[model samples]
Target: MRKPQQTPAQATTPYIDALLGYRTRGMVAFHTPGHKLGKGAPPIMREVFGAALLAVDVAMAGGVEDTRESTGLVRRAEDLAAAAWGGERCFFLVNGSTSGIHSLLLGLAGPGDGVILPRNAHKSVQAALIFSGAVPHYVEPTIDPLWGIPLNVPAERVAAAVAAHPESKAVFVVSPSSNGVCAALDAIAGVAHQGGLPLVVDQAWGPHLRFCSRLPLDAMSAGADAMVTSVHKLISGLTQSSAIVARGERLGLQRLESVVKMTQSTSPQALIYASIDAARAQMATQGEQLWSRAVDNAEWLRARLAPLEGVRVLSDEVLGQDGVADLDRTRVTVSAAGLGVTGYELETALRDDYGIAVEAADPLNVLLNVTYGDSHDDVALFAAAMTDLAARRRGARPLHGAALPANWPRFTRQVMTPRDAFFARSEAVPVEHTAGRVSAEMVAPYPPGIPIVAPGEEISDEIAAYLSEAAARAMHVHGPEDLTLKTLRVVS
Candidate 1:
């Protein structure tokens, strides 16, 4: 007879068991935690977290330590996660996927090394570049002129970038953008491996992809060397909890572990670890059913909104574009341009008037995320609110002025690496006068967090005009001390 297969509960939650076992043992107070597992803490403090939570708030040493020879339960939990996500190794991240991205960069590439990435990457990718002192070879993502949104980067771009920068250490890509548009990761990964490089994917918004058949291919399944995903984004984990999964020998596990540990807190929270493990268990056991309901709920809402004149709910047809291979239907992105309102105005109205919180917004579209936790009732309420707003917009003029420039400003020159410029002598200058100067800091528009200006980039007239226009339109621009765009930081 064949050996019995282990159940989901048996495979996952090893760390949870270890934590709970130690919590239930009722051992003497821990050594480090000043609270000593709620005993030394004030009654109110204990009351705040409640007995059950405080009970498991033990240190990593006494309670959870198994042995040096045998890999601990935390390692087991990570192993289970690796198996669940289809990776060779999985590491639990308590500092969020930001840390994982940093780890991937720091581990694979270092000072003077090149890492090819897309221009529409998250700010964390830039931070990782700075941390690793790696030079970035930026590829432009496909831009949708009609919607004013960046779609996926094509695989040919990745291949061409790799060919151009044959000495580059790794290729990095982000899939299922915040608004749910996805790249062709399998093709991209094949391109990277063909050029003798590892692919590092920042799948921070795609934690549920592996579990849902309807979702796009996850980084692991696509044969990425390494991938970082934020568990809290779509999976039911604590906010800071994430996982970085890796495969193959192209990238060393030791280096990845070092960078991860260096960035992570020495005193990692047991609660966060437990939550991640529990989330893995939940995903392993019941994710398909949960995602089915979520997709149904999203479709229900989209169907209701599609008939409304003012709102145009984006469908999977957008995936048929040249670069976009797939679209995550869970993101109910509805364009408000036809409604004669800015996405910002629509977001404000939804929150203030209807008490509905959306995920994000750009000038044209407001994004609503449907997750396992969402219900049909929740969708019904949001649909009704949107319907009311559509009815109220009886040919009102768009509150916004002009659509953003079709093409964003491209860096004409790189004065220095991001690390060097960030650390070099810097001074603040009037934004208008800094057009020709190399920037010492990043300047990004908030709604779509891509950086219009990054360290070491030569700022251009087009960039200045775009930023000024964004500010004039009351868009929240981040990374600049002067919110009004009057001044900018530049390398002297």
Candidate 2:
């Protein structure tokens, strides 16, 4: 006798299916959205996004089902994502990776807890430090002398930090720096695991790494305890779409979910959730072909740019050095400083003259992100413009890479916890006189966006001077309320 056919639920896109079902129901509307779908929506919004998009905009409750606990569409979507990413569990984040970082830090570390992390962390990690009340044992990253960009900290450094601070609650590391430099994460993960600690890798720039073998190792396969990634950064997802995946019971899944719930919104955007689900499916199904083309374009650009006079394109040779175990070839970082121009200057000229918009830039290098959407024509135009600019070298001024002066303050004494300093009474004072005083805010140079001085850190004269000079040079200084850098926010 023939066996009965078993019904298998579609695994590719459960959230999207639920959303479509909710949208097609012709039920009378009485929901939180006063817009009542596109009927009550404004003309401009409807015309721009269209009625179809607006119609699917819904609340977590009621429309999908009468109660908060419905068909478990969101949970099923998360399961699909976990399966795709090779995580034991996964949680969808609508507020971006910032919230995921904050949630993980809060879940794993608490007051008086020490966490081993590199100092070149994103501003969000600093904020996580403040939010979680975790004390950080800072490790400096290896600097690339050519571009002056901070790469990953050596695994030995992480091991030393873990060994020195046995009381440390967790270890956090950022691989694949914004400039595409990847750290020795497998070794780092081993060190953390040997110490019986969880490794949290901020993989905001590596969502596509798993989809493409040509890319560097992803955090999940590297044995990270918890990994937070921004799907919108390198994958096909809307802005603010992110996900957190957990592999081990070290950071309890229940605890992570609780913290995530606290950090996320009750009225989360349905469209964002659907987009994440869809993006995951697309990557699982079609990412190999898409990223192969992207890598080809990046390789072509690298070859074309390397032969140009005074242009140094970053290559695989940087691997095998301390803190540099691998590289993401899709990111094209060209050193324009040697061409008698600042990365900022080259960026402006490219945009204004050739209509080519690059990604982040500093004094030394310009970063170009090659995505699957880019066409061959786009690459040709960029190459032609770069070659023309190289031929017309302005002057032979020796390149002064954007390395901070020896006196520049890279580290300041931490007198108080970030949480205390953030909540303490504070007053504004002259930036010059802020030396020896405790800071009440974060001050960072923009392009790289690493905080030079965060709350609870003492403000040194060297740091104040460096920041003041950076402002004068027109490098965008972010995080501080006083953009002019003439005043400093300090603990009263």
Candidate 3:
């Protein structure tokens, strides 16, 4: 039987309504005491203004919500989120994906337990290891030399890991990576679940996936046990606003919420929650429409840019290679190899001249994110600007920078659990001398936001060389200090 067309409100999730209610009720809050919703926020802003929205900064009001114990508004919001995302339970994360990952690692898995993780994850994953005290098994990703960016880890690698380490309690992987490269989640999840482990997807870049099937499949639907998303990344939410979707009977909502409460802020931003609700409402009503528009806009943009000289545009072909299942087309990652400039040079010119900033600037490629709000005109303008750039360059282009190091490094074995290495007495060493020693920090190039080296992994000379090249390009790589990577901190 054909299903009835859903009304916007019917599509409106319950979490969306709760968010509306918070805004609708503007009554002065004196109950939580600290918030002073009508009064100034404490210490940080010794404000005396009653009208300041900053004062809306509130505490866990007894009657409204209790994020720590999560029995009030938080409970309802999470319930609705689960229904919206088709997960068994959903947890709100005011602290962002970092906290969600930390909580999942510490709560779902145990000390001495092993967790397999993608080498391309963020620093927060390293933080999770420190807190969880779990041993980590590393999985390397395929680097596309043409793009100079790391792709998602293959399913075969994951399956092999699961087979090798049956004791692994969980696996961490990301889809719709910052550059928009995606992986075969269903296949990875199949491996984890078959081995009696939970698969955790750091789907921070993929919040809009489920809203439109044309984009990519949502992590939950792909059988991941838990998926973390940052609403601020793709939607109109305040920073640090995030959510964790958990499916399957294997996970415990009570335990997960406890971990969140343990790590998250006590005085949660009602603003963050409201923003999440607002995004949810927008998605509920115009999900298919909004995402549909975004996808169409991206398609139009890529097609227009494809013919431009000196511009090599990357697409599903770059992503759909051996290990991946699907590609996210929203990210237009263009390499100026054919042109006479590095991505950095083009990015600087674009900002200075056109006043249009790309998503991220790197040595090789600059990513431009296309959303539902963009129009064909914007795409045409971008293409024209590139054409002008190519014409100016003529036949001249910057010499290709040092070729990326041929061989990358890998960790030998688990010398110590992350929690142990993090806390164990340690000392500083030069980057070159640090090889074979456990790493104390996450060092990675920016733009793509993928860490080439993370905490607890054995440091290597090759890794050091790759990082040095990135720094030479003035790339924003987040990690320990460069050169010697000196003053290294270890378990003390």
Candidate 4:
């Protein structure tokens, strides 16, 4: 893997430096953030976050850069991030990748316009469709029967969708899915461009891909017209920090910027912006070394766990399967089905017994995110915990069920546009009666956050049954009026 070199400008943290300078100036009584530099902060807040953090938790207007006018420091930081990520322009996001996704969809599509996107996209995409009033042409992603998890959407499928819906304003897809399965983005981008549509990637988990050559190709390098990354997911940035990087070839930057600003909070946090800037600088300079270490740590943990009885570590074996063109090695997925335990049970055991919490756990697999922040000691502890768990569960009968039901329903037919159904009068109906009814809310499993039933979609018997089974398994259901799954909201 080639090591990345950052120019002097790329290595500078202009936003962070400016924030620190502002804090050092010791201006009396901040205009907003009633904390007054930690003095007015609650005792518990001061104790938990410390005075230094509160001191710099300043507003965007008078504290860092005036939102009304240009100070150029924040712009410089965003420009450097754009250069680092190989995008024509970049916008730092304080509201996370959700805002970025919203901006992308709203900016690219108008009311009643069509957008082709994978079925396994995040709930934010559905929310964006509702906000933009865009009609969705859903593309089913390849599902791995072994794991019952949704994989990448094939380029051919995208091409077919584009051919079918020639009126689509843009093609959006999620690369390196929540399960670490990456799409053939280069091919997909080509297909979208050939159809005269810009390709937008929801790369929320892959902000580090651009900096590390060892990782899968980033969206920008894969010819995506636009992409959003959550800098905090696998990098050093704080939570809710993200970046929207876009090339203005097809989607105008002015429109994107306007939509982004509209979706974003006017009272944006300075710390989040500074963290994004700092993260970009750090990744541009030392990403190769840091991510190399993280990859090594993940591999070492995988190797250590491979020999454990009944534990299967997923690695490069998933590549070339379905639409998975590459794998993110840092996401270590361990299947504990052979140990006669559900992933939730294994997760509970690890958290309760070993005090180790993984990223997310489904029925058969627990996802462990190993990043630059992890050390050899951390991986060793995890390996040791897995070894102990394996030993304790040895010779147990293997679990016989798949992660998802064999007859799991695909995306149901759209009875109404998401926006129309969302705004239409709706009422709650029994789960069993939901079949054949147009859904007024999204119902999705929480870990992966892909909706099984989106607003305006006709709920089928298979989908209702699958959702009932999922609820019985105690999986967290998101975006529904009733979390118990007893009643579902449908168009009246």
- Please give the CA lDDT of all the candidate structures: 0.82, 0.82, 0.72, 0.88
Give each prediction's root-mean-square deviation over alpha carbons. Answer: 3.3, 4.4, 3.9, 1.5
Clashes of each: 0, 0, 6, 0
TM-score between model 1 and native = 0.93
Clashing pairs in 2: none
> What does the lDDT come to for candidate 3?
0.72
Please tell me which model should have the higher TM-score, number 3 or number 4.
Answer: 4
Top candidate (TM-score): 4
TM-scores for candidates 1 onward, in order: 0.93, 0.93, 0.87, 0.97
Superposition error at 483 for model 1 (Å): 4.6
Model 1 steric clash total? 0
Ranking by lDDT: 4, 2, 1, 3
Candidate 4 structure quality by residue, lDDT tens digits, 58-135: 897878755634777778889999999888899989889988999999999988999999999999998998998999
**What tens-digit string does per-residue lDDT give for candidate 2 at 15-117?**
8777788888765669867788778998999999899988877776856662225667788888888877768889899899989989999999998899998
Candidate 4 residue spans exceeding 4 A from truth: 1-5, 402-408
What digit string (tens of lDDT, one per residue) describes model 3 on residues 111-139?
78888888777777777877777777878
In terms of lDDT, which candidate is strongest? 4
